[model samples]
Target: MRAFLKKEWLEWSRTGRFLVLLLVFTVFGIMNPALAKLTPWLVEIMSESLTDMGLVASEVTVDAMDSWVQFYKNIPMALIIFVLVCSGSFTGEYEKGTFIPVVTKGLSRRKILAAKALLLYGMWTVMYGLCFGITYGYNEYFWDNSIAGHLFAAAACTWLFGVWVIGLLICFSAFAKSSSQVLLGTGGVAMGVYLLGMFPKLASFLPAKLMEGLALLQQVCEVEDYIASAVTSGLLVFLCMCMAVVCFDRKQL
Candidate 1:
C-alpha cells in the first residue's frame, strides 16, 4: 500500500499535476484579497462615468468580509478545475491495462482503490487548506477577520462539499472506461443534487446545501442549520467509496 502510494505521488509529481494544482490554488488565494483591496480604486475610476450618466458611485468599503466572500465565490471554480484534472485517475490505467499486471502480482484491488481514494482526498484537503490559509492571512493583515461570523465552520462546509465531489469522482472512476464518462457521471450526479436542492423543502437535506457557506458567514443561517447537510454529505461519501470498491472488485482490466 505504501509503495503504491509512493508511486502515485511520483506519478502526480512527474506529470506536474500536483504543481499545477498548487499554483492554481495559490493564485486564487491571493486573488481573493487582492480583488478586495483593489475594489475601492476600481470604483473610483468608474465614478466619473457614473456621474455623467446621472448616477453616483458611492465610496466602496472594502473589508475582510469582502475578501472572504471572494474566497467562497472562487472556490467552486477551483474545485471544478480539480475535478477535470483528476477525472482520468482510473481511466488512464484502464486504457493502459496497467491494473492487470498489478492484480496478478498480488496487489489486492481493494488496496489499489483505497490508495487512490487516500491520495485524492489528501490532495483536495491540502489544496483547499492552502487557499484558505492564504486568504485568511491576507484578510487578517488588511482588515479584521473576526467580522466574519462562523468563519471556520463556513470554510469547513465548503471543504466538505469538495470532499463529496471527490467521492463522486472516485465512484465514477471505478465504473468508467474513459475520463469523459467519469466526468459525465460525476457531474450528472452533482447537477441532480443541485436541482433537487432548488425545492425549498428538500434544500436543507441535500449535500448541495454544503456549498452555501456564504449564508453561514453572513449569519443568515446558523451553524446548526448545516448539521443535516453535513451528515448527509459524509454518508454519501462513505456510500460512494463502498460502491466504488465493490464495482472495482468486479471490474475487468
Candidate 2:
C-alpha cells in the first residue's frame, strides 16, 4: 500500500497536476482578500459613470467579513475545479490497463481503491486548508477576524461539502469506463441532491445544504442548523466509499 501510494504521489507530481492545483488554489486564496480590499476602489471607479447616468453610487465599506464571504464563494469554484481534475482517478487507470499489472501481482483491489481514495481525500484537505489559511491570514492582517461569527465552523461545513463530492467522484470512478461517465454520474447525483435541497422540508436532510456556510458566518443561521445536513453528508461519504470498494473489487480490470 505504501509503495503504491508513493507511486501515486510521484505520478501526480510528475504530471504537473499537483503543482497546477496548488497554484490555482493559492490564487483563489489571495483573490478573496484582494478583492475585498479593492472593492471600495472599484466602486469609486464606477461611481462617476453612475453619477453621469443619474444613479448614485454609495460608499462601500470593506471588512474581514467581506473577505470571509468571498472565501466561501470561491471555495465552491475551487472544489469544482478539483473534481474536474481528479474525476479520472480510476478511469485513467482503466484506459491505460495499469491496474491489471498490480492486481495480477497480488495487490488487492480493496487496497488499490483505498489508496486512491486516501490520496484524493488528502489532496482535497491540503488544498482546502492552504486556501483557508491564506484567506484567514490576510483577513487578520487587514481587519478583525473576530467580526465573523462561527468562522471555523463555517469553514468546516464547506470542507465537508467538498469531501462529500470527492466521495461521489470516487464512487463513480469505480464503475465508470471513462472520465466523462464519472463526471456525469457524480454531477448528476450532486445536482439531484441540490434540487432536493430546494424543498423546504427536505433541505435540512440533504448534503447540499452543507454549502450554506455563509449563513453561519453571517449569523443568520446557527451552527446547530447544520447538524442534520452534516450528519447526512458524513453518512453519504461513508456509503460512497464502501460502494466504491465493493464495486472496484468485483470490476474487471
Candidate 3:
C-alpha cells in the first residue's frame, strides 16, 4: 500500500498533476478575496463610464460575504478541474494495461482501487487546505472574517463534497473504458444528483447542499438544514468506493 501510494505521489508530481491542481486552487484562493476587495473599485470605474450614458448605477456593495461568495463560486470550478484531472485515474491504467501484472503479482484489485481513490482524496485534502488557508488569510487581512461564522464547518462540507466526487470518479473510472466514458459517467451522475436539489425535501439529503458553503457561514441556513446531506454524502462516498471495488473485482483488467 505504501509503495502504491508513493508511486502515485511520484507520478502526480512527474505528470504535473500535483502542480496543476495546486495552481488552479491557489489562484482561486488568492483571487477570491482580491476580487472582493477590488470589485467596489471596478464597479465605481464602470459607473463613471456609465454616467456619460445617463445611466444611474446602483450602489456597489462589497463585504466579507462577497469574498465568501467568490469562494463558493470558485469551488465548483475547482472541483470540476479536479474531476477532469482524475477522470483518467483508472482509465489510463486500464488503457495502458499497466495494472494487469500488478494484480497478477499479488496486489488485490480492491487494494489498487482503494489506493487510487485514497490518493486522489488525500491530494484534494491538501490542496483544499492550502486554498482555504490562503483565502482565509487574505479575507481576514482585507475584511472582517467574523461576519462569516462556521468558517471551517462550511469548508468541511465542501471538502466532504470533494471526497464524494473523488469516489465517484474512481467508481466511474472502473466501469468506463476510456477517459471520455469516465467523464460522461461521473458528469451524468453529478447532474442527476444536482437536479434532485430542486425538490425541497430532497435537497436536504442531496450532496448538492454542500455547495452552499457561503449560505452556511452567513447563518442564512441553519446547520440542521444540511447536516443530513453531509452525513448522506459521506455515506455515498463510502458506498461508491465499495462499489468500485466490487466492480473492479469482476472487471477483466
Ranking 1 against 3 by lDDT, winner: 1
What candidate 2 gets wrong by more than 4 Å, as runs, is none
lDDT string for model 3 (59-140, tens) is: 7878778888888989889999988887877888888898988888998887787788778888899988988898889878
RMSD of each: 0.8, 0.8, 1.3
- What TM-score against the true fold does each predicted structure earn? 0.98, 0.98, 0.96
Q: In candidate 1, residue 164 scores what lDDT? A: 98
**Candidate 1: where is the Cα deviation over 4 Å?**
none
lDDT of 1 by residue, 1-253 (tens): 8988998999899988999999999999999999999999999999999999999998989999999989989999999999999999899999988889889999999999999999999999999999999999999999989999999999999999999999999999998899999999999999999999999999998999999999988899999999999999999999999999999999989
lDDT tens digits, residue span 1-253, model 2? 9989998999899988799899989999999999999999999999999999999999999999999889888888999899999988789999899999989999989888888889999999999999999999999999999999999998899899999999999999998899999999989999999998999999998988889988998899999999999999999999999999889888887
Ranked candidates (lDDT, high to low): 1, 2, 3
lDDT of 1: 0.95
Please report, in order, the local distance difference test score of every candidate based on alpha carbons. Answer: 0.95, 0.93, 0.87
Instruction: Give, for candidate 3, the lowest lDDT window spanning 10 residues.
Output: 109-118
lDDT of 2 at 220: 96
Best lDDT goes to which candidate? 1
lDDT of 2: 0.93
